[model samples]
Each structure stands twice: as C-alpha cells, then as structure tokens.
Target: MPALDLKGCLDDSPKFRKRIAVYEDSIQHFEFSLKTLTKLTRLQVDSSTEYSQRQQELATDFTSFAQSQDDPIIAHALEKFGKSMIEVEKCRTMFVSRMGQAAYNPDVKPVIQNSHVTETFISPLEKFVKETLFPIKELKKRFEKASDEVDSVLSRYMGKKPKDPTILETAKELADARKGFYQVYMEYVSKLNDIEAKKKVDYMENVLAYMYTKSAFHHQSYEILKDLEPYMRDLTGLLNDTRQRHDEETSESSEYQDLCAQSAVDIYNPLNAVSSSTVSSPGITVPYHNTTENPNKSGYLFERKGGRVMQSWIRKYFSIEGEYLVCSMRNTKTSKDDDQSASYNLRVCSIKLSDSYDRRFCFELISPQRIIVLQAENEKDMHEWVNSLRMVNQKALNSDKAPPPLPSLHRRGVSDVTPVIKLNGFSGSSGTVSDSDKELLKMVREKPGNDKCADCQAREPEWASTNLGVIVCIDCSGIHRSLGVHVSKVRSVVLDKWETESIEVMLELGNTIGNSIFEEHVPSDMETFRINPNSSPIERDLWITEKYVKRSFVAHKDDKAQETVNQTFWDAITEGNLAEGLRYLARGANVDYRNPNEHLQTPLHRSVQLGNEVSVEFLLQWSSNVNEIDENGWTNLHYAANSNNVRLVLGLLKRHAKADIKDESGKTSLDLAVEHQNVQAVTALRLFAFDKQHNSSPANSLDFGFREAMSSFKQNYSFERSHGTSHSALDLRQTKSHSPKESSSLHETGSKLLRSDSSQ
Candidate 1:
C-alpha cells in the first residue's frame, strides 16, 4: 500500500480518514492471526511430547510380555522385537526434542545456534506491534488535535477585518499552529508507513522461519531414525547373547548376591556420615555464598514508605552501580508514582541495620535529604547488602574525587537545593550529587564565557537555558523562565540534573559564542541600551525580551542572494566562525543544504567529518535534521563513527540521531564504531538503546564525559570574553545618552576586536 501523505493528514481529507481506517482494520486482523498462530504452535509442541511418551509406555509393555514367553527361540525373537521397538521409541523421543527446539525454545541462542520460532520470530512481531503499532494510535490523536487547532486559528485569521490591530498577533498564532500541525502530520505519516512496511516484511520473515524450523525438524527426525537402524539390526544378536549369558549367570547367582550386599553397604556409609560444620545450630556461624567476581550487588528489596497519610512497603529492584545506589520500580507497568527510578550517591550516605522498624531484615540508608528504610529477603541478604554499601562508601571516601557532604536542608530553602530526580523508582527526596554531576559542573563552568551570565555579564552565573545554550544569573533566569520553556528551557547549573545532550550544547556554545550570535548588532551606546548585573528588574526584562524573544539585535543581511547566503554559511562553518555562520542563517541560509561540490554533504555532515563540534551544535540549535543523509546515504552519525570520533558520535546521539539508520554499505553507526574498535562509542550507542528499551528519561542517559581536545578548538578560536568594559548599574541609570561619535567608535572597535580574535 502507498504511504499516507502529510498534506492529506493536515487537510483532514475524507479519503485520508477512510484509508487510515482500512489500515487500522488490517493491523487488527494481522495481530489476531499472529497471536493465534503462536498459541497453536505452543499447543502442537506439547501434543508431540505426549505422543512420544505414549509410544515409550507401549514399548515397555511389549518388553514385559516378551520376557514371559514359553519357548527360548520364540522368546529370543520376541525379546529382540521388543528391544527394537524400544529403539524406535527413542528415535521418536529425539524427534519431539528437536521439534521443541525448532518451534519455541527461548533459551536457544539466536547467534551461535539457529533462531528459534519464539525468540527470533514471534518476539519481534510482538515488539513491533507494541512499540510501533500502538504508538501510531496516540500519534494520530495528537495529529487530529493539531489539525483542529490549525483550522480554528486559520478561521480567526481569515475572519479578521483589514487594518485590525490584532491581525499580526493572530497571523503569528496561525503560523505557529500550522507549523505544529505540519510536524505532527509528518510524524504520524512516518510512523504509519513504518508500521505498514514492518508488518509486511516481518510476517513473511517469521513465517519463513517457522517453515524452516519445521523442515529442520523433519530432516533431523530422518537422521536420528537412520542412526537407529544399526541399533535395531544388532538387537537380534544381542538377544541371543543375553540368553546364553543368563544360563551362565544362574550358576554365579550366589556370588552376585554377595557383591550386591557389599555394594549397598558402601553406598550407605557416606549417606550416614555428616560433617560437624554442615549441622545447623544457633551458635554456629555460616559463611555466606559469594557468586559474583566483583563487589557490585543487585537484587530486589522491599522499601518502607507511605503516600500522603498511610504507610506501606513497596518492592523495588536495587543495584549498586559505581559508587551510587540505584533503585527502580519492580512493576513498571502498574507503577502509579511518577518517580520510576532514583539513584543516591554512596559517598554522602551511611548504611546500617535498623531495629527501629517493626519489619525484620531491615536496614536504613541515612543521607542529608531523607532516610530510606529497606527490607532484604533474609538475614544473609540484609548483611550482604549492608556490607556491600559500606564497601562502596569506603571506596568513595578513599578516592581522590569523593563528593563533599550534602548541605543541611533545614538551613536553606528547598528551591536552592537540587530536587530529587527519580530514575525509575517509586519514592525519593532530592539532595546530594552523584560523582558524575561534579565533573559535569566543572566541565560546563570551564566553557568560554561560562564564568559569567550570558545576559548582563553577571559573575558566576548559576542558571542556564538548556535549549539556548547560555548560562545566566538568578535574576536573568527568572526572566528566561517567563519566556516559557519552548523559547528558553531554564535549568540549574548546580541544583538540577542535566541531560547529556543539554551539556553537549552548553560545551559547544557558551556565553561568548551565544552573545556573538544573539547580540551581534547591539546598539553602540551599550550603557544606555544594555543592562548590567545591578540593572533594575524592569530594564533586565525588556532587554531580554528584545534580545531573545523579538530577536531584534541578531545581525541580518536581507539584501544578500539566497545562494550567496548559503555559501557564506558553508564557508563560515568550515572556517569555524560560528558567529558569522549564524548571521548568514539569519539571512535565510538553508541549514540542511546539500552542497553538490562537497559530495552532497550538508553542513552537519561537513562539521562531523571535520570534527568541529561547535558547528554541529549550532546546526542542531537551528533545528537541522540529524538523520539527513549525504549523496552516499550516510548520516552525520555515520561519518562521526567511521572517523572514530566518539565525542561527535555521542553528541549526535544526544541530539536524537537515529542510531539504526544504515548507510549504502548496510552498516549502522554502531556497526562502524565496532569495526573501528571504538569501545566508548559502542558503549554510548548500547546505552542509548538501553534507555529506549526501558523507557528511561533522556536526562538519565550515561554521560560521555567532556574531552580535553575541545579546549584546543576553543583556544584556536580565541573565545575569551572582554569583561573589562563593564558599566556599573549606577552609571547606566545616570547617563541618559552619549555622543553619536563615541557610540560609533566604541561599536566599531568592539566589532574589530571580535573579528580579529576570531581570526586567531
């Protein structure tokens, strides 16, 4: 079937709805049929087992009847026949075993052994239905909602009279709604097409596998029966020999009886004797079983906690990863709490057995934020968990980079502290940093211009706009938050958990680089037009709105030709001059333009190939598609991994680059990374996959730590901000205006400084 079109979806075409309904019906039918097939296949395997057992029973009965035969010759023949029947029964039993392995054994290894019907075939069908098919229904609902919103906005836009004061605002809203609709429409169609294509190939592949398994079962049965033929032929001779031996054995019966009695005594002696250590006693100390090669421990534990009023215990899966204690909900599907997972820094917590609780086998983990009460399976488990925590905590304390003690909650406001972020847990309170957070803070603060606020040039900015890639003071952060999360996603530099991708953006574009793009055309009278750290809240708010919201100061060259603008963007990025490149983007350069002169590579591809992360970050902020392919159908991720640049690979993945996209060689980014032995890159990709499988929040993805090499790039660009010319907030309010000549001179000099510094 042809894929649904976005235009049809956005227009809400009747034909589109009809086609979608038909597709939905087909999907339902396919699901029903596949589930039925799985159920019947399992039944068939069970039935075959029963048939083999029945045959074995008949063979045993025949052997008993043969032993009661009257004549020796006839008895030998009958006995030989019974023995062959038993051999045939064994062959039948082998058939059942092969059939089960071929049909539905999950334990069968898909790599080293042939793919089984369940793990390789049926499981993918189920996953595709769950992960792909079901999500399409939700996307359709959102698309319809967006489509209706566009209609409503468009109706208002068209109904307005000419020269209405609200016309511009209405037009902007209409445009935004239309843009939202288009995005949802495209996503819906993409998912619909994906599921449609998957069902076709998946069903055929699964059925082909099922047929192959059946063929293998029959082939193996033939081979096994063929091998049994020699055993059947030898049965007649075996029966004759057995009759002759029986006659001789009758004479040695007394000797056999004596040997049996002595053998029984020998077997009983070991059974009767027992080591003193093996005996159970209240005073005895038993050694706990240690199965792991490493110190890390993971298992289920019941934690005591309560809702708003009533207290109860909830089972959770807990594990020690590095120097942190991580816990996740035991039943993810039924979990009602939004906190599905959580991790605590072992360096800031102490673990000990607790008798204060009524529950037995309980321990308490005391931290600055809250105390967690956990119950283990038994006495041994409780001891092991406590000992493990102690060991990890001691290791952290002995390490050179252990985190400092968390601050007391009672001494400060809750807003000043980091809120507890649950990874996949039921209950938690926020405080303390995992060791990774410290390194993250150090790396981000070390960025150019990061020591001060992007706005007003305030010292030691403690907040950041994750989307805009700029740090700001607490005052500017309040203004950023007012702009709404869509425009500027404000996050704490100290008190909040930062996602890996957000940090990548921070590392690439700090205050200096961000200001160069956003404030490229700031008025020359900086004291009059701009605000400082001590500026009034009103002035700060107005300046921020004009700079970020209205984007009035961003340099634009409307007169430049489209081709010239794009060429300048390409050139500026190649030269690592992001400010100039961003200026060209403002002039209407295509961020995703595929230049034929460079093997049809987009700016993103070129940046990754050149190992310039700043350009890549700029393109991403501009909303360039990370999955866009070059002339060879290779994404920027492919280029990064192929070049063995793990940072670029990680950065791309953080920006939501599709890891499964294959190049012309049918190799994914992971495949290329493996080929190059990029261990870190491979680990990053695998972790991304794990996050998806567990439905984890992207904020918790493993951070591929910052690289020292990026500092060299920053040095080459000379991005050090000039903070010497700061005007005091007092001086700014006193000076109403300055000479036009003085303003022009200062602006010209600052521009020259920026250009010259960038050149170096």
Candidate 2:
C-alpha cells in the first residue's frame, strides 16, 4: 500500500470541504473582531462622543458570531476562535484599567493634555495589533483546527481498517482528501508561523526604532519646555511626575510585549527545508525510541533498530564535511535500581557533500519516543532545524552577517608630573661636619689649651674645647671625655651679663688676650718686609704703613715688645704657613709657644695635627723632639695616631717616639690607633716599642740596670693602668712578685711615668 500524503488532501479534496469552509469563516470573524476592538479603542481614546454606543454594538456583534455556529466540530472551532477574541477583550480591559488609573493620577494629567506626546505613545501598539499580531493569530487558529480534523479522520481510518485489503482501499479513497487537507493546513500554518516569527523580529527592530524616536521626542519636549518656561509652574511639576510614571510603565509594558511576541514566534515557527544550492550540505538526524515497551519483551531487531534506520537514512541523503560521527546519549533511567532499558540517544554526523568539502549536512532526533528525526542538508537545513525547534535566530549563530564586536573598556590615564627638591648647605642631621665646619675644626684641632694641670702646664700647649664641651688636644680628643660643667672655651666667664653683652665681653677679652699674647717684631731691613708693588696699593699700604709699621716701631723701641712681636709673627706662620712657620722655631722661637685664643700648639705639634707631612718632616729634621706632648697631654705620636696617617705614625716611631704616651684621657698612641681600627699604625707602634725593649740589657750595670729595669717596670704598670691591661691586672700581679720596698718604688715611679707620659 502506498503512503498517504495528508498535506495534499487538506489542500485539494472537496469531501468534508464544508469543514475547511467553516474554518475560513471563523478566521474571518476573528479578524473582524480584532479590527472592531482596535477601532473601538481608537474612537474612545480620540474622545468621540458615541464611543460608548459603538463599543456596545461591538460586544453585540461578537456575541452573535459566537451563537451562530451549529455543527459540533465547527462549534468547537468557533468556541476556540471566540476565546481568542475574548483574549483581545481581556487585553482591552487591561488597557482601560491602566488608562483609568493614568487619568486619575495628578502626574499624568499634563501628559494627557499634550496632544503630540500622547499620540506618539499610542501609535506603536495600534500599528502592531492591526498590521501583524491580529492577522497571525486569526490564521493560526484556522489552520490548527483544520490540521486537527484531518489527523483525527486519518488516525481513525488507519487504526480500524485491515492493512492487506480494507486499509489499502480506504487509504486510496481517503488519499486525496487527506493530502488536500494536510497540504492546506501545513501551508496555512507554515505561513502563519512565518508571519508570527517575522512579527517578533519586527517587534525587536521596532523597539530599537521606537527608542530612537522617543529619544528625539524627549529632546523636542525639552526644547518646548524651555520655550514655555514662563507658563510651566504647575505643568513642570506634573511633567516630572508623569515622566517618572511613564518611564516605569513603558519599561514594564515593553518588557511584557517583547516576551509575548518572542514566545509566540518561538512556539509556532516551522522548520525550513534544505536548499539545493550547496554541493555538500551539513545535516543531522536522530531516531525516536519505543517508550511504551519493556526492553526484554520488545523483540526489536538490530537491523530494524531506530539507530540503524537513522544512520542509513543519514548516510543516503545527508552529506557533511567530516568523516567521524559525534553522538550524545541521554539516559532516561530513573534510578540505579531501574531496568537498563533502551537508552534515548541523539547522534550527529558530519558527511562531506562536495569534493572540495565546502558543504556539509546534519541530522537530529526531534522526538525520540515517536521515532521522528529532523535532517538538514546545509546551512539552510541547519536554520530549518533551528526553526522547527522554534528557537530564536540567535544573532550569535548567524553566518551571513557577523555580530558587531564589543567595545574595549580598559585603558590607562596620563602619568603624574611633579618636581623634586635638592638639599644643600647643611650636612645631614647625623652631625657630620660641612666643608666650612671642617676647616674651622682643623684649626681648633691643631692648638690645645694652656689651662692644664701643673704637669700639663709644664708642657705649655694651647687647647680648644670640643663641640661636646671637653678641653682636649689632637690626642686627648681621640679619647672619649666626660663633658665638664664650666663653659671655659667661651672667651669670658662673666657672671651677670646679658647674652649680647656677654658676646661683646668675650670678643673684647679675646682681643685683649690676642694683643697681649701675640705682639709684633721688626725685621732688620724694612725693605724685606715691604708690601709687594703688584699688590692692591690701598690694602697693602694700609697694612704695611699702619699695622706692620706700628708693630715694627714698638719692636725697635722695647726689648719685651720685640720678643712679643717675634712670638706673634711665629704664631701667625704656625696658624697659616707651616714652612715659613718653621723659620721662627729655628730662629730661637719657643718650640712650645701657645696662642691665647685656644689651641696653643707648638710648631711641632701643629705641623703633625694639620696633616702636613712636609712640615712634620721639616720639624722632625730640625731636631724637634718626637716625644713632645701638647697641652692636652698628647705627644707628637698621639697627633699622628689621631690623624689616622700610618706613614706619619711610622715616621714618628722611627724617630723613637714613645707609643705608650698617655693623654689627659689616659689613652696611649697604640690604644687610640686600635680604637680607630688603624691596623698599620697600631702594628708600627707595637714594633717600635718592642725594638726599644730589645736593645736594653739586664746585667752590665746593676744600679743603672736596676733603674732602667725599674723604669721599664713602671712604664708597663702605667700602660696597664691607662689602658686596662691586655692581660688582667691580677694576672700581672701573680706573674711577678717584688720586695715591698721595690713595689713602693715601682708605684712611685709608675705615677711619675704616668704624669710624664701625659705631659709629653
């Protein structure tokens, strides 16, 4: 028996043709009702005087149409058709209810009064129902009813008749009717569904269009409001309130409309057929399984299996780009304990449809339980499958036109530009000296004070106070000293003086001391002391004729004045020029001469303290004692140690300078060197001391030897006292025992040695 083409019967047959006629008639009524309702709404909104009377007439017409239907099938169809009209009424009631609420609102009154704005807002809904939604709805009902009738008639005939004779006979007789009915129904529904889907697409497009139009309208309203500012006192308030309400309502309504339109389109759109333009097409098909049977009792053969049927059909009709099959299975077993029945699986395959493999095909299992499969031969076929499923045309999936790329959101801002500061003048607050302070500090370091202990006074050195207020020489300065209470470094110690007065008094005292202590002397020939001819005449003449001439005159007249002048010149040379300064010492100038203003360094000590190696060599060569001590009890070796110069220290030691000489703080040159980590200086000092000890003998002269040995013993004792012993004092005592008389003598000698070491 041949298969029946139900689509043809629905389209062409005359038998049961009245049913088709009734369906068409009912659709017309549905369209009329929609149009009537739309017209009534417009009339009412337009403020027509007879709108109430017209609405009454429309309700009567709708009731008459519902009552006129007589045939049960036709009546049932009409009832469903009427229900659609009732839905329109329900929509109308909702609109009226919203409008009534809007009318009563104090906010919306002014918006309603604006004729332009109100009309613009109502136009889209009016156009939508009239042009798209109503027509689609009417057609959908008509075809859906017709399709149902055809299916019902065919199903009854197929189920009751025998397949061998009655079935074939009946099917042939019914073939034309069935085909005609189905053809009309499918064509109509397909077209209706297309229209409905297009309406959804149109809705989104219209929304975008409406948004642009509304934005422009808002701009125009702003301009109008600007021009009407003088008359806007109450209207502006109402406008603001109405705008708020309108925005909220429009947002909600637009959302609802979008969802409804999209749903209708998604649920009804028909799958499109594959196009023949492509050589190879992409397609997929899935077979339905028998859900009603138990897996063990079904007797389903492998060759006759749904999967095999689907695979065969796909291989025969579908062509894809790939060779391998991709299949997904959805197991419907309810639990772990449930029987392992036939699994409902969807298999997709890609078959090469062209020699170039440019085109492919696909297939899908649309209804697993019904054994229905959907096939696609190319891109168009894929679209058809998507359409059959009533899915939205996901813009993301479309190949014809690519989606616009999303805009970039990440970027950086310009950098900050500010200025930096440069520090100068002051050294860091760590108390390190600036270059100027270092110059002054060097001068102070060269000279020590004269107001020392009797023994220190004998040394006749000048001392300056440290920044910490302790009086120290170059050597004593290396040792940490206790800060004394008296401010002796200040020139004057006046008890009852103001700060300014004290400063002036100090300056006067300093000048008095400087003038008294540093007197001028004259040379034998005035020409030798004459100002240079090339020098600035005024400045040179002033110094030569006034200061130098007066001092010269005083020197020539008095012997005391002459000696004072000689001392002053010697002091000036000692402070400034070490070479010229040495001439004074060679010419009977005191080696230990001290200036009044602090730092009373002898020529020898000053040279070493100033880090003047040439001057120091000159002084040492001139037979200046290498062991000479300053006012702070610092010897020349102490100055070398404090200077941190290993060459100068070795030079001094080579000249037989005592390494163990202590300053007022009781630090020897070796101790000071070690404290400062001057390793070479410390080694040289130690070697010199060792050499001195090695040259001395123990037996030749008992008394002289005993005295020398006693001196050595005292020197070592004083060294240990000044610098806490490298070996403990207890160890020193235990190692050597002497008679009480010798011990007493050693103690006396040790005290004297300590004093002598401090002085030199």
Candidate 3:
C-alpha cells in the first residue's frame, strides 16, 4: 500500500466526505470497545486459590468421567458437554480479541481517519461476531447449564465427600435432574451441531463479500495515485515533495483534484479478469495420538534427536509442537511408536548445560514434573536442539527486543523535532549565540541577592534548580536532588550545562522574582528559611522544600515599595526601557527583579526570551545574576536556546552560560535544544563546550569554517531582524557554506551529543 496519498485526498468530494465521517464514527466505536476489552481483561478472575482449585477439580473429574468408557450415560454427557462448552468459550474470547486487533491495526488507522471506508474494514468482523461467536456462545451457555446440574447430582451422590451424604429424597431428586439434564444436553448439542456444520460456509461467504467490497475501496483515489507514481518509487518521495511544497509555498490550489479528475478521461480500459471462486476438498482427519503427540501443531523444526534420560543415553527423536518439546524413544517414524513418548511444555520448562556431565552433547531439561538428562548424538546436533528449545521458550515468553515498536513510536510529541535544527534561525540560527545571550547572562549574574541561595541567602550559591530558578548552596542542592527531579531540578552553576532558553528563564525570574512569591505572605513570627553551611541533610531538605515547595513563611502580596521596584524593573525590561532600568540599578534596586505575576519572571529572563538585545546588554552590564534560575528552574540560556535567535545563544555561551542546568523536568539547556530540534543551538552549545574544554574561542578554534559560518549566520540573522526582514526556512537552508564536511562534522557532533544525552 503506497501509504494512502494523504495530500491527494485534498479533494472534498461528497463521496470522500461521507466516507471520512463514517470512518471517524467507526474509529470511535473501536476505541471504546478496545478500552472495554482491556478493562474486562483486568478483572481479577480465579482470584482466590480455593475457587481456582475447585474449578480444576471439577474439570479433572469431568474429563476422567467423559474419557472412561464404563461411566454412566449421564456422567458421560456431563463430561462431554462441559469440556466442549469450556473449549468453545475460550476459543470465542481469543478469536474475538485477535480479530479486533487485526481490524483495528493502528498502522492502518490513519487511513480510516481520513476516509469513509469503515464498513469495508469492519463489516466482516461484525458478521463473524453475530453469526459465529454469538450463536456459539448462546449454545455453549445452555450446554454449561445442563452440565452444571449433572455435576451437582454427581457431587451429591459420589464426589469427594467423606460419608454417604446421598439420602433417598436427594437420590430421587438427582435421578430426575440427571434425566432433565440429558434432555437439555441433547437439544443443546443438536443446535451446536447445526451451527458447527454450516459455520465455515457462512464465515467464508461473509469474508468473500468483505474482500470484494474492500478490493475497490478508494479505487478512484488509487487510480489517481497510480498516475502520480510512474517515476516516484516510494510514497516517501511524493509525501516529502508534497509536504515541502506545501510548507515552502502557501498554495490553496485545487490543481491536485483537477489533475486527478482530468487524468481519468484519457485512461484506456485495462482488461479485467472475471471474478470467480473455486472450492477444494478440505480433508478432515481424527486427531488421535498415543497420549503424547500434539496433533494440530508443527513448529520450528530440528530433525536430530536427543535422549530423554541419562540411563537411556541412546539418542531419541524430538520435535516441537506448539509450546511443547515432544521426545520419543524411537525415530519419529510412523511405523515405530514410542511407548514412553513424553511432551514438555516449553512455557514452564527450562533447559541449560549439564553441570555434572562434560560431554558436549549433554544438557539438562528441567520441567515441573521431572529433570530429564538429554544426550545428543553429536555436539552440533546438541547445540541445534538446545537452540530450538530456547527459541520456542522465547516465543512463549516474548523476551526479544531487537525491533520493539513502543519506544520508537512513542517519541512523537515535544521531542519529535529533527535533532539538528542548524539551518533555521529565530531569524537566528539554532546555535552560535549572540550579544543578546551574553547580555542576558550578565544581567542575571548582576541581579541583587540573586547569586545567593534563596532560602539561606548564603553568599556565592553554587547550585540552582532550573524550574524554581533559585540558586542554592551545595548542601541544599543535594537535598533538592533527593526530592526527585520533579520537586527540585538542581544543577551546578559553574559545572552544569545550560540551554539558551533556560538561561532566559533564569534571567526572567531570579532572587527578586522568587522571593516576592515565597516571602510575600511571611509572618514576622516565623523563623527564616535560610540555611548555614553546617546545616545537616535533614535541615537542608526541610528548609529547601519549605522555602521552594511549601512556602511555609509566604505572605500575601503587600502593596509596598518592594512591589513598586519589582513592577518598574519588569516594565522596563518588557518595554525595552534600558535607561529606566539603569536608574533602578543605580538606586540599589534588585537587578533580578521578579514580577508579582503568576510566572514570576525576571528582567533578563523575559528579555532574552523576547530576543531584546538592548535590555539584555543593560542588565548584563549592571552585573545581574547570570547563573540565576527563574520560577520554572530555567535560566536565560534556556530561553535563548528555544528561540530562533542564535545571537541570544552566542551571548550566553560567551559569558559561560551553564549548558547543563536542568529545567523543572530535569532537562538541561542542551536537552531542551535537542528536544526543540534547534540544530544550530545544539551545535553552538557543543562547540562552545568543546572550545571551553580546549581553551579555544570562535576566532581561535581549529574547527574553523563551520563555526565561522555559524557565527556569521547569527550576525546576519540579527541584522535582518533589526532591519525588519524575515528569511524563510528554505532560504536559511540555502546559506552559503565552505564545505560539506562542515555540516557532516556538525551532524557527527550532534549524534555524539544525543548519545551522550542517552548515557546521562
């Protein structure tokens, strides 16, 4: 299937629209039914040991009586009806569930989402449930009811009771019940026979109808697709071209529909083979075996033989039948039937190399009933048999992981962007930070009291939480990390990585930003939350959580001088009032001013996110806390990283913006870059880290051309933005480069960054 041409389906014909609506309704129904089935499966069946044991006992007694040729007529009927009904019930459940999954395969689900082809896919399933399972289920129930009555009488008369519990009245009642059960059983069996006899014919007819209906589903669209694909090999080509064109140029042209409809007239009629059906004899044979063979199953074959017991060390034939590894004393030939043929269920059986024996052909098979020592004729045969058994075991256990679909498919949301978004800029490149980034960092570092721990007010706080954006002492950082990444995303100021976007967040909400919310409602009588260097682990945790999480001493937002200072600072940053912001800094005002708003963003944080170079430079020059965090535990770098402004990223990296600072979710600025697929940002961050480690800068770094191009790209982007010019993504991708090696190297670096991230 050439991936149902999604773009071609732009045609809003009445036929297509009708189909789309029907498809949606069917999908809803399927989803609801799936959820209901899942819930049903979760029900605690056979919950208690006594209940399960009783069921087992009933089944065993019934089987034994049914198989015994000498059993009473009523007993035989009870056993036969009971076993048949149970098997049918199990079959119905499994078949329905498996069929539902096939009918609702998620891979093909999107096709239905855009079409009205619901009846084509779903009608056969509905028919099967109605004609096959429903009728079988009804008959099975009647058979079970009759069997239960027979069982009741048998239990009363001669079951596991210690004494003769059968009185004259009870015996008489049992006889009447037995006769009544026989009558019901016969009627139920007669109906069941009728159903079984006609089931295949009815089922095949329904299936044939479904196939014929679906074979022509979207036939018109397929014809259009066929015309579109003479040169195009895979759907990927057409899809990519269509998507790229759609994105590159905003066109609402009806050319696709017009072309499709116009092309239909010139198409010559191709010879069509007349539809016909043929029936062949499906021979049925009785599945009779000498108690050991699995008649219906033939699985992965290993022809060689291995002995069952060490005493019988002569090699014997073994074959897999479903989940069983059946061993026979003789070759698996029709003429020679082994009397001691044994079958071990691979589901519960474990095979391993024999510890006591040195022979290469010897291995041990441990089952629930016995430990069998098997000896193969040769080492190669032994290895193959062992491998075959283990392979069967794996099929039963489902432990292989090479091509799992869950993890790969689940990564489609926030982290779904291309890993290297180097080409597109915020009108800025992904990386190659700017003067704006540098200024934002400087401003945050200069913010008053922002450098110290929010709780302790300890000088030179070395650690911070990206989400809370509050700097903390090392002791408190440890306590914060212990709270789990959710409660406190702690990172080292100097040592950690930082994304440009998170750095911006830190600038937005630093000390002044955090304190107002945490301390707004503080009572004078309450003890301060600050901790000393000597504070114990418990003391640090209590104070940290209480300060950041609990807000134990928080006060109501008071209308005071502090509020005016905060509001003025935020207003200056928001409005790009560099002069006014300077005055506040001159008057000993808080540099990292937090807004009283719910976001609690600081000046530099908001400015970087806004890509305001002037405000960032002014704040940075004023010596604000660059390493400070905002309420969301993000720094200025984080904000810069998320933006298209490569200049903002450059500014922070030049100022040594911590690239490793985790946000509220424990994701670093680099992680955010990767998540957003800011390829340029990722490259710049990694390059900066590499340069920093090697004591190199953009001008001096030996990895020359690409880094220079990135720097140049950032400058050009800033210039364009300043001049009120916007470059399209395609134009950005067309930027002049010195060599293919530059991009290849960047790609390699990005691949390494991803691998490093996984290791972290």
lDDT at 435 for candidate 2? 43
Q: What is candidate 3's lDDT per residue for 1-760, written digit by digit as tens?
A: 0112233233425564354445435434544563454344334221322233344456556666655434233343445344433332222222222222222222332111211112332444455455544564566576568668877887777653455555666778788877776665555444444444444456456446445433432332233233223112222333465578887555434544444445432121112111111112122111111122223333222222344363324445566766766655544454443335567777778988664764445788888887777765444445556776777776777844342221121224322231121222122222223456657666766777677777766677766666555677644555665566645566545433344655765665676666665655565555554467655344666776776556564542343476686677678767876545533443335878776583767888888888887567657644556667878998899898877466778776666678888889998787877676665567678767776677443333333334455655555545545664323232334554333554445544555665565567
Cα RMSD to the true fold for all candidates? 33.8, 56.0, 34.7
lDDT tens string, model 2, 1-760?
1222345443556643454455446545645654675566556556531332244345445545645644332232333333333323322322222233343222443122322222333455457556765665566576667667667767767787444557766676567656665666666645544544544565466445545434543432343223223223322343465689999999988876665554423222223332223213212111111122112111111111245434432121211111111221234443443322222222221112222222244333333244333344334434443332222222223345443333222232211111111111111111122344445433332334323311112131223221112222211211111112121221111111112212222222222232222223434554344333222222343433332123332223333453574576456545654433432432345545554454555666777777665555545534567786667888888888765555567567656677777999999887666565443344445544544576452112112233334334433433443454322223434544333454445434433433343355
Error of 3 at 150 (Å): 99
TM-score of every model?
A: 0.34, 0.20, 0.25
Sliding window of 10 residues with minimal summed lDDT for model 3 = 272-281
Alpha-carbon deviation at 45 in model 3, angstroms: 99
Backbone clash pairs for candidate 1 read 340-424, 340-425, 341-422, 341-423, 341-424, 341-425, 342-423, 420-430
Better of 2 and 3 by lDDT: 3
lDDT against the true structure, each candidate: 0.64, 0.40, 0.53
lDDT of 3 at 100: 24
Instruction: Write candidate 1's Cα lDDT for 560-629 as tens digits.
Output: 7777788888888878776567567655679888887888888889988998766777677667889999
Model 2 TM-score is 0.20
- Rank order by TM-score, top first? 1, 3, 2
- Candidate scoring better on TM-score of 2 and 3: 3
Query: Model 3: runs farther than 4 Å from truth?
Result: 1-560, 696-710, 716-760
State the local distance difference test value for candidate 1.
0.64
